[model samples]
Target: MIEKKITLVPIGDIDDSLLEYISQSIKTTFNLNTHLIPCQDLIGCVPEPVFGGRYNSTTLLKQFHECLPGKIFKLVAITDLDLYSPIFSCFFGEAQLGGCCALISLHRLGQEYYGLVEDKALFLSRCEKEVIHEISHLFGLLHCSDNNCIMYPSNNIIDTDVKSSSFCPSCNSLIERALV
Candidate 1:
């Protein structure tokens, strides 16, 4: 069997530091090895210009699927553009939900997006939470009711900020089982 791992795919010009930070967090959180594929590897995954420039999250997810590594691995594609799914107007991220691919957008994670001053620290925190939430779903975990859990859906920035980056106890247990 192929070793299970997590691979970070950048949809475009993403900061290396940010990707490294998220990679480290994923390693520590799920106790799985993480790989960072440079931006060039995913430039092809960048969707063609959409009507308003907002890429369809599902389309990007499919693109990422084509680039998945041969080994059993979870692919998390990060981007700076806004993203939307057919089901929602716009979402922080979208996942195949128990499949091998997921996508997260950094567009809405920063304070500046809301007309506030830019907060890099807070933006990184929010990005980390979204990454964890989406990966957990790829592991077959669903949304949680606990408001403070990372798995809880964030309807707005406040919802994202209110939640902890760590998973709730039950969600953690589910993750543990999935790992096994």
Candidate 2:
């Protein structure tokens, strides 16, 4: 099997278990060697939701690029923002790069959003789905019409809760093909 290295760069302090689940999911699903790196610049990006927030993902990614030369990585910025605020989760989409690089956000992964479901199992499942969905975009998979699929567009917490943690058959096939 052709091995790919997937890196997760944290934008801020987040649950370590969530990070571990991400690494495991990437390895099992995509057969990749995944690494999680905590970036101080990313962590310091916590900005107030009102007015212009300090979190600028594009700027952060550009800064990360300077540190790792020619190393393709996925920088995920996780924050405990009240995503339900009139202010939407400015969480950006995954960007496809030449050397397998991209970025994702964990705005909706907050516990209280899902009815304060602080259970780590539930949190990890939600996190894995979001991370997988974003990573799939880097491989050219668009949003899926299946509501039960992870690739489905989740405009709110209800949508995310309704979706399953696993990809549907079609999406699974697409990912398998990409790996090949």
Candidate 3:
């Protein structure tokens, strides 16, 4: 497998520190080169959440193709205007251009209920987990049963926080196999 880079497309005005943490986490964990492609227009492309916005993997990928060739494995992360389940929290898809992927963030990633202050560190951790979760999907890994693994689907913020930012042994083994 030719080690490919994961390119991040920043959709809106996401915090700079959050973006830095995300890029660094992926690179450090996977040893994959990562890049951030800034485009203010991405905000217009970002749709409202499913309950509140109409965005899907297909539409988002196409918009990215117009701006980037897909072979490089691109990923887009957007800090949306509203919060939703982690089901709608992140998305990734193969680009028609080549061995590429695109992803978007629905919200900043945290428990925002009950007036609890947003924990920047937790948000960073969630973002790291989600980014790896989606990127692993591109490499053909499924949701794992391990609750502490990043590949586990997070139905709520509690699940999100409970999950670790790295995959469990089984999932990690699968990733190695797929990369082989």
Candidate 4:
């Protein structure tokens, strides 16, 4: 049987360190090997932003499915662009629930985005949380009620900062079962 692994695709000029941190975090969280693809020129290829410079995340997920390799067990695309869905005005990320493709954007995660001082540690923490949250959805997990859980939906940076990067007990069990 072919060994399935999680793949990380950088949508544009994403920083290497951010990708590396996310790749390592996913490997540790899911106990699965991770493959980081080279930066892709998706900014120009994807549809232009509709309004307020936000790209529709659902559309991007479809593009991700078309462009990403099929052999991987899961695919997560990281971008610095802002993202949104029809249901929400703007969000940190979006995933294909119970599906293999997920996408995350760092546009709003950074403190600098809000005109505050840059905090690298805080920014990375938010990124990790969002990455794990989106990937968990790919594994058939839902928005957990436990606010501390990684599977919890983060409506804003405060919610993201409040949640831990690890899964809560109940969510962890579900993840284990899904892995089987």
Top lDDT: which candidate number?
Answer: 1
Candidate models: Cα lDDT each? 0.85, 0.62, 0.63, 0.83
lDDT-sorted candidate list, best first:
1, 4, 3, 2
**Model 3, 1-180: lDDT tens per residue?**
534677777666777777778788877777777777676534445454475463565555556666564354545545454433333443322222223554646453654633678776776777777777777777777878999998887766677789888889998998777655
Whichever of 2 and 4 has more lDDT, that candidate is 4
Candidate 2 clashing pairs, residues 3+ apart or interchain:
11-42
lDDT of 4 at 163: 88
lDDT of 2: 0.62
Itemize residue pairs with steric clashes in candidate 3: 48-53, 49-53, 76-103, 78-105
TM-score of 1: 0.91
Q: What is the lDDT of candidate 3?
A: 0.63
TM-score for each model: 0.91, 0.72, 0.75, 0.92
> lDDT tens string, model 4, 51-74?
698889998888777765546578
Q: 1-110, model 1: which lDDT tens digit per residue? A: 76688888787689889988998889889988888776566545547757487788888788777755556478888988888787754479999889998889999998
Candidate 2: Cα lDDT at 18: 71
Model 1, residue 151: C-alpha shift (Å): 0.6
Tell me how far the alpha carbon of residue 55 in candidate 3 is from the true structure, in angstroms, after superposition: 3.6
Tens-place lDDT per residue, model 2, 62-93, is: 54555553444444444443222233343533
What are the runs in model 1 whose C-alpha is more than 4 Å off? 39-46
Over 4 Å off, model 3? 1-3, 40-54, 65-67, 81-99, 106-108
Window of ten residues with lowest summed lDDT in model 1: 38-47
Global Cα RMSD, each model? 1.8, 4.4, 4.3, 2.0
Worst 10 residues of 3 by lDDT: 90-99
lDDT minimum window of 10 residues, candidate 2: 81-90
